[model samples]
Target: MSFTTAPSRWSDVWLVTAARGISSCGDFLAASALTLTLQSAGAGGLAVSGLLLAATLPLVALAPLTGRLADRVDSRTLLVLAGLAQAGICVALANTGGPTLMIVLVGLLAVGLAVTQPVLAALIPAMVRPADLARASALQQSAGTLGALAGPALAGVLVGSFGTRLPLLVDAASYLALVAAGLLIRTRRGGGRRPGPVATGAGIEARAWRLRRDPLLLATVIGVAGVVGAVGAINVVEVFFIRETLHSSTTTYGLVTAAWTLGMLAGAWIFARAVARLRRDGALAGAALALLGGCCLMVLVSAAVPSALLLVPIWVVGGLCNGGDNVFGNVLMARRVPEPVRGRAFAVYVGAVQGASMVGYLAGGLLLELLSPRPLVAGAGLAGLAAVAVLAVPLRRAARAERDVRPVSRDEPASAGEDAEPGAGLATPVPGR
Candidate 1:
């Protein structure tokens, strides 16, 4: 039993990072460019927001199928195909004259995104050393944040100066580059052994059924759902909190958002360095508390004080917690779920989080419409606090259980195949199923 050299491991990191960056760039551009394209095509307020809802729907509805596909086939190949599909949709969207056609194209693009994201996540464990999982997750988050910050601004400028259609073209081209980067990657397949008869097809169904019986997974979905909900609420109304609550203008709101983004970037870098000192659950618990505290501070400030001077610190702290929460959640998912079921497990995880987010945004908007910005902001904080309190007991139990569990050594060879062949095949094996 031997290990790969450090140089080989580093190459894998580069491959995964390249793939994520390219994909994030293309995704951001497609979504951003499409918004302007639709507006130009005579979309109204409700119609415009509906396009976003259309995009998010596939992520929730198609997750189980996409998750299964990620585990059952070549993840990199799937990622490449997803990118190509999205590129085609971007072209279709750019040329479309009707609102219906544009909406259809964006929906297809979203479907591609739903499939691509889980496959990209599943690929990380295959590419990096097990001990480096948290660091890898952090790097991925940082890359995504940087891509997101650059991508929309780039797309906006292109859309305004060149034309809305041109940004779509740029997005399509980035997907082409993403495909090329994926081709350059040469990581081991499936991350473990090929699935046995029981672990293959009906096996997938069984796993889904079995997940319903597991209290730990269920509790995790709930706790993480609340965190995601809090994020969604912030996304919808944080700008309003700055403008209305803090009495700042649009430019000031933009600066506050930028500060938040910077905070997230810094937090990711910090987590990559500090991950080794904390157990997986400890990391998640700490992140949850941080998020809870940040929201509490923001709400208190927005409701009681409402000062523009506090906006920078509030958004920065919240954004830092947001980034930490993402890294922690990804690591916990990778560590707790078995390798074979990881895709579906993550899919469920993704769906739960996203679904909760949608609800939170709606709740925030409704609350704001009915009451005031102060109450809405304070409510988010209260929700975060309640989530922490309710989930604390279960979280502790799960953490203890997970700590007692040990991972299979990389040196141990499975009987299904000689070794995991580099670059894709059947599903990986579950460590302790």
Candidate 2:
């Protein structure tokens, strides 16, 4: 599809995008304000870590159920509820002064976010035609990246001038705006279809096995998880790298982070155009992984480079690669998975990424005790490269297999039969038929 091709449902796409972008900005603002609040209250490192844990740990735990709900329920309704819940949490946060209360509010907010994410992912493929999926994915990502880039700075300004509570109030208002946007979206898929039976533990396991049967989709999930795990180490050691290794000030660190965000925004913009011309499959996903690995390697080089000025552009490139990988990964999942099971697949994907990142954070902390930031950064780069090397052949084979398969029409039942492995027979119809 040409990048310029406007689908009839473009308004729906933009509405969803706007909702996510605004909500994300509010989320970041709330997070920053929460952190600042804790810091000013003289909270210990453990207390701060507890806050972070509250924000992320539920994502891993509730992802499966949330994903299932996304598939069975009206996504617009789920989004609306999630937005309202988050807005309430933010309002509560604004009023609460105690650290314990703040922690509870943040956890509730995180739950809302966790529920919203997979539903949003599942909703996108249904929002636009297959041809425009890549562009739509890119546009969605661009909105998120732009929001993330702006949110922190806005939070910093608000907290510095007014106070942390004001930002929380603003964040609550943003969630109301998100709810408004959610209401505006109209899905072609009926809003009130009876959801399939909720998956039990055994059923969840079965769903996972089905996901694995699709080689290309599995490969995409693993590749993304690996890269995320590897690159995540930088989050742990970046402060030390900036201050001790490079002898840069706190302002420089902020600037470097902004540079990466800017790069992500640019990358998302560039890839929206690029994806229109490229084939959508595992090979494209693999290429994106390779680019991401190369970017991580650049981070290693940045550590060794003497000039802080040079690091900005390097981080920017890293951000570009990160953004590209995200776009390609989303497009691949949308194309490969059937609508019936998309929520489960996305749940697993999100879990894998988050779980892997958690592992990386723990490992990075351990490694920092024994090694300098430069070596740790270099190791992260190498880890990314290694993951790409291991997955390259499988990804290529999956790509070829996909290329040989005839495309499935929108009206066709995505699953060939009740017992058929989803996506296993891309070129063939059900055996009985």
Best by lDDT: 2
Give per-residue lDDT, candidate 2, residue 346: 74
**TM-score of each model, paired residue for residue:** 0.74, 0.77
lDDT of 2 by residue, 180-259 (tens): 87788876332465334333211232334466677777777677677667666666566556656787644455456556
Q: Candidate 1 on 1-433: residue-level lDDT in tens? A: 0112243365666667766666666666666566555544544434444565566678778888988877787766876787788788888777876777776777788888778777776666656554454445555666666665556556556766676778777778877765775677776444344443223211233344445555555666667666556534544455456556677644454455555555666655555334334444444545544554454455445545557656677666655655555544554444345566666767777766666666665655555556656666666667666666766667677656654663434453221122211111111100000
**Regions of model 1 farther than 4 Å from truth:** 1-9, 30-49, 96-103, 131-138, 155-163, 188-214, 238-256, 272-274, 280-283, 286-312, 364-378, 396-433
Worst 10 residues of 2 by lDDT: 424-433
Pairs with steric clashes in candidate 2: none
Worst 10 residues of 1 by lDDT: 424-433
Which segments of model 2 are wrong by more than 4 Å? 1-7, 32-53, 94-104, 130-135, 159-163, 188-191, 194-209, 243-252, 276-280, 305-309, 366-375, 393-433
Model 2 residue 351 distance off true place after TM-score fit, in angstroms? 1.5
RMSD to truth, every model? 7.6, 8.6
- Each candidate's number of clashing pairs is 0, 0
Tell me the lDDT of model 1 at 193. Answer: 40
* Candidate 1, pairs of clashing residues: none
